[model samples]
Target: MTAAAVETKIPASAEWMRPGRVAVLLFAVLSLVAFLLPDGVLPAWTRQLPAEFRIGLDTWISAALKWLVEDATFGLFTFKDLTRGFAQLLNVPLDIATSILSTGLLDGRGSSAIQLAPPLPWIAVVGVVAALGYRFGGSKLALLAGGAFLYLAVFGQWASAMLTLSSIVVAAPLGIAVGLATGVAGYRVPLLRRIITPILDLMQTVPTFAYLIPILFLFGFGPVAAMIATMIYAAPPMVRVTMAALEGVPREIVEYGTMAGTTPRQMITKVMLPAARPQLLVGVNQVIMLSLNMVIIASMIGAGGLGFDVLTSLRRLDIGRGLEAGLAIVVLAIALDRLSQAYAAGARKRDAEGGLKPFLFGLAAFVAVTYLLALFVPPIATYPEALQISTAPFWTDAVKWINVNFFNVFDAVKTFILLNLLLPVKRFMMAQPWPLVAAMVGYAGWRLGGARLAALVVGLALFPVVTGQWDYTMMTVYLCGISVVVAALIGIPIGIYGGLSPRAWRVIEPAIDTLQTLPSFVYLIPAVMLFRVGDFTAMLAIVLYAVAPSVRYAAHGIRNVPTMLMEAGTSMGCTQKQSLRHIQVPVALPTILLGINQTVMLALSMLVITALVGTRDLGQQVYMALTKADTGKGLVAGLCVAAIAIIADRLIGAAAQKLAAQRSGAVDAT
Candidate 1:
């Protein structure tokens, strides 16, 4: 036959030879081969890295940190001296804030002495907060703001709450400032973005507790150190959000600013920043939530506040006191989250009215009236002791009742889960030969992102093994694996319900916000109370801490499905379930996957905190290392956790990209 005739008869084979398809086939084959191999079956060399070839990164990091702390000097000042100087500088404001919040300016020496700047009375503080809320957000927010503070006072938690607030008052603004500057710089400079993006990713992934040891060493244990850690922990999200917001500003707005004869500064300040206000406020909200979340964790190193109260209660097994403090944290978080969201939504509307001056005047009037009342009504100034209510007894009785009635049931469920699910999965993961596991991961990475990603994944996987942290790392993976699965099971359905119904959305969204805003440490309280401190309880805490993002993203993705498509499906006589299954679910799958990615990261971040509830994962190693001042071990373990997160991020990110491409292709074809 003629060559042309033969070519015509044989259909083009190139479609089946696509890189993605080829990669997948290769991954499947390789993974199957690896899986079928005996647990210990590997070439001798692939079992572990040779001792001499190991990098000793831990030793180097420790040495560098040691030099910085002990020997490194800059002129007359050592690094420790410099860190302490900054800490002391920060301490001035913190001390003043504490004094104002707790003791007032009278110094508790004599009430008659001429007071310097006296602490604003509790009534005045509440009035100012409510006024500010109303000024920014209207009556509903005013009620929420007023009610939260009142709850603090009536519960006799005013002083502890104030202490926590004082730290947040100091930390949140500093975080915002630093984040804004860094974000702007990163946006303007590609090199800076490249340098800082990875750092921010690392910072976000690392557990908050992991930060405390390094900070404790540098600045010593105090509110200052806690504040610094809080800033570091909270600032990265703001930086990331700000950069994203700035980058996402419409090009036309910038051009408009330039055409209007605006300078570079004016363009950014007036055009880009204003355009980016929604996202920037979201970043601010994140900072506030994260700062509050850090409160209890920071208490571990001597930061005083409601967090300290909660910690003390937990240590003493005073579930009643712990719950009260935890609830206060939750209430404070919800109020701040709502206030910030409301303010962001209303800011543009208020700006259009040109009513700033009247708002300020009204605020000033409220403050003045409250101050006047404070001078006359001492009970209003400071919450009267006689009127202070204690719910601790009620909570204690509740806990006792729950323990008496429900402990056995919870214990049985915990045992069943541990035996039927977690233990087998963990053992299987741990028992896998390192070579086979690494090969499978590498192959999957190759399937998703070619040789470069494969190399990156292999390197990340090997790092833990080389550091002798493989067992602990696998333990973490097992714990996170179970948590993510359970979260997806719980969160995805809630997300679907919320997506389909506005009423459900309104109800679920706020609950998700509250759950997300609460501190990681807070989850441990109930877990400990109910399940009583073990791997099971720890997993439960991680699940609670990690589930919100999945639910949120799923709902968002589903809600955002194209109206035209929905209508088209309906015109074809597709029922709701049929339409959702064939249309919305397919389109939303990519976003749902991204939500799962976020859940994994959140679970990893919670690992160290969960260690406090007793789990022998990498988190426990870091915790132990911190207690012993073993910088090398702590840093190594933390890096291992970051590595796991990075690997998961890259793999899932690639899948999401592929799904997006498919979605685009389908749209184009239509």
Candidate 2:
């Protein structure tokens, strides 16, 4: 060992006992001081603050907002009326779809004039997918593609799944078409993109429930309205992705296309779109997952099928039915995702002769069986009662057991959370006075990024406070904070362990995917049963939903760190722990932070669904507004949630950018 190495190595130490010691000490002191203070300490402290510190003067503000909306809409713009109007408009498409199934020239009538449409011979759908898959990838992918369709059919959900699939089938293409056009528009006319970008940002961050109210109003409850709403919600990402992919296409390739005397349309279709195919497929995958996520929610306004059944079960507290329906959704989502992924993955491996013979044979066989069954077996469309499956009994028994045995303990935990944890956090944020908190957040942004990012942070953070939702807004923040913290506690270590080996990555990836795609509501049932309807349940739900991003990005970022650097650390006699702590972690921090940003967004999005656990937060406001048909109220609440999302996004994103730049600079210097 060298003398320099001996000098450089310090005595055994803990990171927590150094600079963080002061913070820990201060926390302890503050907690002690809080404990020593009288029960009226908060009230006295609040009294010392300026009057403007107060939030949400509800009655006056409500009246003023009502008047503003009335005046803005020329006295015919009440939210309820608007929702009613939307519902009426949406009814047309629902009526058409329903009438087609219920009354058309098709099947044997079942009571109401409506008769079920003969299921599309499964062979056709499968053949198209197989061909599409083969076109996208190759033989293995085509088989995977065929299998996904076969699973849907065998599972007896072929009919309803197809209905959901049809809407998405329609919405996905429409989204792609719109996104591609918009991407081109944005790329060509920067001004148009500039105008569209913020709306896109707002659309992505805003609670879907907020949009649902207005959509239901304009279109009325039905599949078409649901389709419209799904498109609106899911389209932005594709547009952004397509634009990015096109912009990133090599300048040389494009010039080659131009030099080849290709027309603009031909160049884009043959050159740009095909070249940008990979990213666009990613956008499509996003669209599929997002659309499926909304399947249950979309049913609220008349989009029917499994999602409707899921929602119905939720309302009835039939856990078996909810689980069955929710699992069905999960299975369908997995199937579509796998098929899409296989297609995309296979795109680079195009086959010579296209394996046309085998594919055609498979298609022929599938089609023959599907139509034959449709003709001979009426039961193919609807499964028999004996085949119906459920998980509701387990949930109900669990719910009852918890309620009976743990009610007092749960009550105490809830009270402690509300009175001690949540209340104190809320009061502290409120006590700071809005300007100070805004300034602090802005300053942090400036330190991490610069003036532009700081300005963005301030604007987003202040929006909700100015809108008079600061109190409930903070409640949402508190819940998110708890979830994010808990999730990080679990996720970061797992991510670290997973990043160490390919085997771990294989095990972790599917878990992450499952967590990522499982509908937000699915978590609500177990959370309510175990935790039993309080802040804790909501927090638990958020944590489970939010953990995936952290685990995914962390593992990805760490594993991707240059092996040469690890070798250098090894050459330096650094232990594995030291190499990871001092080398890998610093390099991976930016990506990990990116994961945290995603986790926060996911947690915020969970606000609407988690309200089943009884929160007094902004989501509850949105929920109440929905039931009361108060569009203005819902919009305001939705905006508050968006404000929280935007602020977190900006601050964390800026910090990550700064960290990446710092790491880059350090690398250059090395």
Candidate 3:
């Protein structure tokens, strides 16, 4: 083909080459060197370092950190004091759950006491859900809703699932109500947005463990505390997301509403919110996912049902039980996710279908099936070991095999990483003088964000050092760095290839969604089985969990690059690689940066769960605080993590904004 024809086919090529045998050779060399290198390479390397390095350089940093943690640092906040305060606060929820468990309707006394909440008659719920689905989309969605409810019934988990569902039924709407109020307030008032934004960021980024202690202490256990915790923990995302979506609704629509004699509330309800439905739905999805994610964690605080089952199974290392519970959770998640998604898609279908006739039929079918079974079959209780799916032999054999074969290999690798890499890197981060660290962070902020971002980042970075979590915070930073690096290594390239191919995106999207929805805890078992405990397994878990965002963002960024821009590159006689490198990448850089930012945030969020695998970081502190019921300690540690998240978010997001502005400015100048 002619050069022009070739250019039109794609774009200019940026020279690229695949390595031939280099990777294998490099690996061999590294392996050889690893054997040759003395294990003491780390100790000697650190031994020669100056004593004045990080220690004497950070006097003010140490003092500030010490002051921030003084109450906990000196053991001044006694466990008894914290425990007593928690007891006093648990009176209400404790009373309610106790009444349900101890004596009442469904208190397990008389035949009538064994039944609870009327089961919504099953028909009503299915009808509502199917109606919602039909209203949102139509036949496909109606089938999905009908099927999901049927699965619950046939699987013999209908009652327990419904009990869990009841909390969500209460919690989600409550979240939306709070979110709508907060979102409206945040949008209308600059000061409220300013205050709520940081809190929202903290809530979104901090591990769930941080919230549990406070909720447990304040409300005690059971569905109430669980509900309260779920609301508090999950509501911020909804509120923030809703506020952003609503605020972004077309000004013209609001003006039109005003011109049409609408009041402010009418404009918001009838115009802005409707126009922002896609984003609001995303908020709803986030709320559902977050609430469900916390369900298992909430069980630890006294919330019952599947979460409790999952917790019990995990504690006993009963993989079969855990898998069943996890599967139930996943099934519930899929049901809710598909049902909601269909509802969103069904909106268009609603215009065609006209009414609820189709939904009603499906609902009637579900009710007939569920009620007939519920009336006849005695309530299915937890099965005996013989009946349950037991992976004990398999998991035990697998763990034993790994312990025998890979233990030495993993131990050696872990030692090298901890001693040679992670420790020194952590020490260096912690060692930086506060002023120097602030200056560097401020510069990064200014370079990427501007003066406002720079100021915000510097302040956030300085806070944890002041709070005496400097060391622990540094450790979190290190783990995040490791996870982000690993995730990017895996995600960015996968995203690029997927972005280049529509067929790939189609295949990959479902996989990505599954990975994203899979609870972070579910992966821990396999990770521990493979890598054993310590930082390696934890890091691997974080990386695996965090990779989804990076891949998703990268693919989205690349795919969303304007078609006109691609055509322009082709018109200019550029090759595909050249166009991607010189044009597409530059334009997509801002969005790609956003993906990186997400990856970091997600990695940081997973750190607390990683702590359960035995990492001596802030996550450990948060986890320990939860078990000990040390609210203040947990809060401080949580804040420290929040500080880290906010600082990184500001820096990266600011950088992306700056780059976007620069690109726009250059385009404008041209």
The model with the greatest TM-score is 1
Worst 10-residue lDDT window for candidate 3 reads 11-20
Using all chains and alpha carbons, the TM-scores for the candidates as numbered come to: 0.90, 0.82, 0.77
Tell me the tens digit of each residue's lDDT in model 1 across 79-134: 99999999999988887887667655643444565565546678877777787788
How many clashes (backbone N, Cα, C below 3 Å) per candidate? 0, 19, 15
What is the RMSD, in Å, between candidate 2 and the native fold over all Cα? 5.6
Top model by lDDT, which number? 1
Best of the two (1, 2) by TM-score: 1
CA RMSD per model (angstroms): 5.5, 5.6, 8.4
**Tens-digit lDDT string for candidate 3 (479-585):** 78877988988998888778889899888888877777767676676677666678778888898889988888888888987776666667767788877776667
The regions of model 1 sitting more than 4 angstroms off are: 1-51, 106-118, 260-266, 355-376
Candidate 2 has an lDDT of 0.72
What's model 3's TM-score? 0.77
**Which regions in candidate 3 have their CA more than 4 angstroms from the true location?**
1-113, 116-160, 348-353, 357-373, 377-420, 571-573, 665-670
Which has the better lDDT: candidate 1, or candidate 2?
Answer: 1
